[model samples]
Target: MPSAAARPWRARWRIEASPVQVLAALLVLAFLLAFLVVPVGRVFVVAFTGAEGGFTLVHFGDFFRTSLFIESFWNSLYVAAMSVVVASLIAVPLAVILARHRFPGAALITTLGVLPLVMPPFVGAVAMQLVFGRNGTVNLLLMDWFGFRIPLMEGLNGVIFVQALHYFPFILMNLTASLSNIDVAMEEAGQNLGAKGFTLLRTIVLPLALPGYLAGASLVFVKVFDDLATPLLLNVTNMLAPQAYLRVTSVGLGDPMGYVISVILVVVSVIAMAGAALILRGRDFATQQRGGGGLARRPLSPLGKALAWSFVIPVLLLVLAPHVGILLLSLATVWSFSPLPDGFTLAHYATVLRETPQFLTNTLLYCGLAGAIDVVIGVVIAWLVLRTKLPGRKLLDLMAMSALAVPGLVLGIGILRTYFDVKMPDGASLATSWIMLTIVYAVRRLPYALRAATAALQQVHRSLEEAAENLGAGKTTTLTRIVVPLMAGGLAAAFVTSFATAAVELSATLVLATRDVDAPLSYGIYVFMQSAAGRGPGAALGVIAVLTVAVCTYAAHRIAERERSRRMREGRATA
Candidate 1:
């Protein structure tokens, strides 16, 4: 009934807010439902509901009745709490030194301190056991010097050591940002009021940095609590995550107790992250004025330098010990309860290369596929949130971030629960195929990629897209040419990050892997490490994971550096 002119306008409106956009929005909704919500919902349903479809707390009752389950729940809580405390102690000083002082090798130390993150916690657990174990170097020194060895690598203490070292950088990264960006006038005003030294630091600086500290500490707590591999590797099995994996696998997927554990993990993770966000909601921690030079850097005196290094050197040595130990272990012929290996050989590496080429191949294929899917979805989500006027984009963004809070073991169980009976159009069960592993990898690693894409997109000037459109290009063409090219380096970095991380994902992969032949490098490494003779091969495999992640991490840094240099040159050229 519309006129021709009105029809044209309506057509344009339809194109602008078209079926394509609607389809895309629907796809996002469906994807989140299929991958995240349903699986998690299934877990809750199975956890609290009986097989007869009646609501009951019987599962939880059964779980509490078992002393081991109660022990595991508390053990998880204790480990997480201790990890936060120890990680804070280590991180606070390092962040203070790096952000507020100028010193030799400070830059290098900061970089190396973050390297532990590139290696998976479980992968490094192997090397950490060798270095920090009671019969290890520190103990060896103590035993010879004082005839006493610390229990650094025993029981829950062992989990705390690895997790603290591994996760302190999370706090360090956040605290560094906070300290560097803190308003200089606040400190100057406090100093003018006669406050000085540690008192000033305690009352003024740390209070201002508390938000960042809490943010990082909460993440550390959640991550440590959700982790299964580190505890399983360290032989500390009485934790919620490990128990979830064991009960579901050993007792079969129908176990209600496993689902109860999954729901608890999911709840705790969401609560921890939500609590952080809620605590920051009403506060205005923003600095009114940030100086050009950021925080003031004071140079250490000669004696002060010695004291600083005295604290820092031991930490650096302890942090980098895993890297050294893993490499040495890979080549060691025999190493057991010794300060150093008795002998060395290259046979382990040779063995890995000569046999089990399937794992290497599977890793390459799975990671590559997952990385591509991640980048594609990330770019779409980033564009929708940043560029489009589409509905539910904010919801899409929230869902993406929430994925990080889901423990991999829980996700895996959810996938199994939700899709075990799902059949492909080709009539194959999706739950029993390698495709399931790929899907799990993609979902699990999507957050990192999405964050990268969003950040990269934010850095891009809108005028470039406008200019392309001004030249008669469509939105798609403008995006494909102007935007994608500008974000290529960032997108590549995102892809590498996803790929490298997916390469080492064990928890979800362990559950989703239909068979051993489809298993990736992490499972292979875990299998090898279960036996005494297999330690050498396992170390070698762990080395491969380390190198895989390290190379990708190095490349991402290089790409970022080049992009920064290019931007600087462009700014200078324009100026």
Candidate 2:
């Protein structure tokens, strides 16, 4: 720490870092304006403009007038709502079980719960066909034994099932976090007042966890609503996203109807998130007790444990089925109208690895740079919002998050429309370039990284930074030494999440990738899944994708677990 002699010389040291500060702030502002605001603004422009180049609502009117459009709109809403209900039903009980009790396989259960999030919904949809399709495993067994087969993978029902199974982890994560933070006194007091079983949970637990649950639910709804892969792959085009995709891809880029759908997606996303926000605003979630024991874990009786396992085991199997099917499909040389593969071979893996090294290399290049960009921007945005007094920082926060409101398809279209003709500094067309693709990835996944960074920053004591300043360190030095180090783990989590998600991103890539070689694993998988003989190679690529994502996810899980354990130890010592 510097002494008083250095203090006077170092006063207003913040101004000394203005160049770095100003440059970063300006860069972020430009990036947001250029990529996010401009493209979205273009969508609204095209969506609302008439053929004569004046403002009109004819596009929306046309959309509402069409039976297909109207049906797709309603179908989207129906599927999203059903997904939420089913996901909640599956998630709430498991969250309660995890939070309120200490049981066998608790740790394994948590790891499994988070696993689905790593796989893209559409990618999972492919393998899901093998496990839940009409002639798939479950239905085959049902047909053999019970003389019945459920339509698990039929139409929008299939979309909802996959969505529910894949997305329930959102609710599970939120509810578990909320439950862990609930004061033990609340539960004990409720019990003292004669509340028990579902009564206690409904009144005390659910009410408290409501905000987190709804937040998660809203996210699931938006995600399912805007998702392009699942509905398309399942042949369920009577949904808004699939409609938008089909409209834009099939008809022409000049059609205003697709932009209209994009506008609707953006609007619905904003409204959903805003509704969740409104419900949570001014509601204090702070635990009444300070630094004491949190929610108490109840020890389950033998029968209770058995019952819990009974509920959990089947769900776990259903969740794991897609991955198992993918692995089998990748290795199978011939899988047809049979219960099992007729033959297996390593040839598929070898073919993909040899024929298309670009798929893997492009993914690494694109996702790595995108992840790094996300982390840097995320840390900068978090600092600007929480640490600095920069003007318009709130708008920066808003814009970064609003990227989430924009679906991948819309953003991809926006990018194509806005940048297709534009030339780079070197006079190269921006369309379908790796740089453009990387920008999309970074912006699309920016919210996740920003949220993680902001949350981490909020946890750090402001006093720590102030001390460095008091000791005559400048803002940059202090941040580098204190804030960045403290936030490294969270920033890494943010990076991994962004990287893994972008690795499997398809909607945007589908539009932006000009050639097959420019495409990543997701587009390759989609292309391969188109052919019967290509399914093995596609599945092989998928396994590679899954393994890549799984490794990152497990690393993140370990980091989170270590952080939690450290915090618990600190809290215990303090108490």
Candidate 3:
């Protein structure tokens, strides 16, 4: 330790003395804005500028005055708000129960709850259609068994229903994490002081969990609001995402009006991000964290047991129903007015494989590139924030997190505005190019990898790194030999997640893809669903996307599990 006399000038010896660190920092910040911020800002510029480069508010005027656009914007907000409220109501109690108690298949249940997140939104849309559409499974069973039917899938209601089912898990997962950190000792004290049941919950549990609950709510709200594919797939024509797509594709407005809508979505997202920052201000979650321990379980009374089982069964069904429907549809030979398919076959998959090799190759290449780019930039950004004393460290953190709010459609449009017309000296252009897609995917997925890397770095103590340096290891050697190996699991997790998300990215890909190459599975599904014999092929492609994501997510989970087990074994051996 430095003496008091030398303390003021004795710096922390930040990990930034070398050219490598400086270069990495500069590359990361440039890449981040190039893909994330600059393109986003371009939306505003394109929206307000004339063809001759003059400025006007005609785009905004058109957006507000047009009946279709105004209605869609309002509808999008309405659906998002309602979905958040309903999902939160269901998720909060379920999260509390899961966090506070243990039961059979607890791990499986938790995984199942989060499974929807890995599946693409379009898959959810297809699945919900099979389960809840007119003459769908639910209606068919009811009509056949009891001569009764219920209208379940139509209009905004259908969109909200599916969204709520798919996103409730998001709220539940976040809430579970939040609630698990609440101190049980406080509840124990209250109980010992004559507080019981509802009273104890209201005064002790609820107050402590409010911040987390709100955080979950905010996350779910933003997720629901920003989602475009789900609403489109569910046939909600009057939604902002589809509306923006129409403006760019159908209305022949090019990107000016599209940019206006994208700007609005971005503004809304910024508000949500601000709310999250305010909720979490100055709170060190790691320090305040508590374990979900010491809660004793007792056999429930008969009726109580019945109620518990009832709740569990329906939630399980709700979560599983869409997936089951999609899987069945993917394999179905035909499904017109049939309770079940008349036959099952792999014909759809075969047809797609034979007819569209480009889809497979394009998706793999783009997703792979995007995933690689995301991991590299994410690691660099994490290092800059954690290992180096960058000038704008806090601002970088905020910017990274803030990307979560920018809708994918909005981001895609931003990319178009920024690089569509830029020419290279050799006559190559950036617009709709493979490199551009990779960059967009990288920047859009950066937050996930950055967050993962940051967390992973935190786990491997800095002292070990410093010790390596003191023992004659160079900075690069120390990082490569010690830090990278230690954080391999987290990096792999981030890579797999980024890959899965990129594979299924629709809104952004739609903007970037051309007929020749770069059109991914999501874009293909969207195109096929518009043709005759399209539903089957679309469902088939949806299954493929879902399976791809599932495989990657599963790989990530397995890697994480293996690493955790190894660490525990090593700890035991050391002890």
Best by lDDT: 2
- What lDDT is reached at residue 401 by model 3? 68
Better of 1 and 2 by lDDT: 2
Task: Output candidate 1 Cα RMSD.
Answer: 3.0
lDDT of 1 by residue, 1-575 (tens): 88988987887665345565667767877887898888878999999998798999999888889999999999999999999999988889989988888989988988987988977889788888888787786788789999998998899999998998899999999999899888888788789999887888888888888788888999999999999999999998899999999998999988899999999999988888888889888887776775464567889889989988998998889889988988889999998877889999999989988887777889989998989988988888898889888766889888877789899999999999888888989786687578888888888899999999999999899998998899999877887888988998889999999999899998898788866688889988988888889989888998998888889899888988888888899999999
- Give the Cα lDDT of each candidate: 0.87, 0.88, 0.77
What is the number of backbone collisions in each predicted candidate, taken in the order shown? 0, 0, 0
Model 1 pairs in collision = none
- RMSD of every prediction: 3.0, 5.2, 4.2
lDDT score for candidate 1 against the true structure: 0.87
* lDDT score of residue 513 within candidate 2: 83
Task: List the candidates ranked by lDDT, beginning with the highest.
Answer: 2, 1, 3
Q: Which of the two candidates, 2 or 3, achieves a greater lDDT against the reference?
A: 2
Instruction: Supply the TM-score for candidate 2.
Output: 0.91
lDDT of 2 at 435: 90
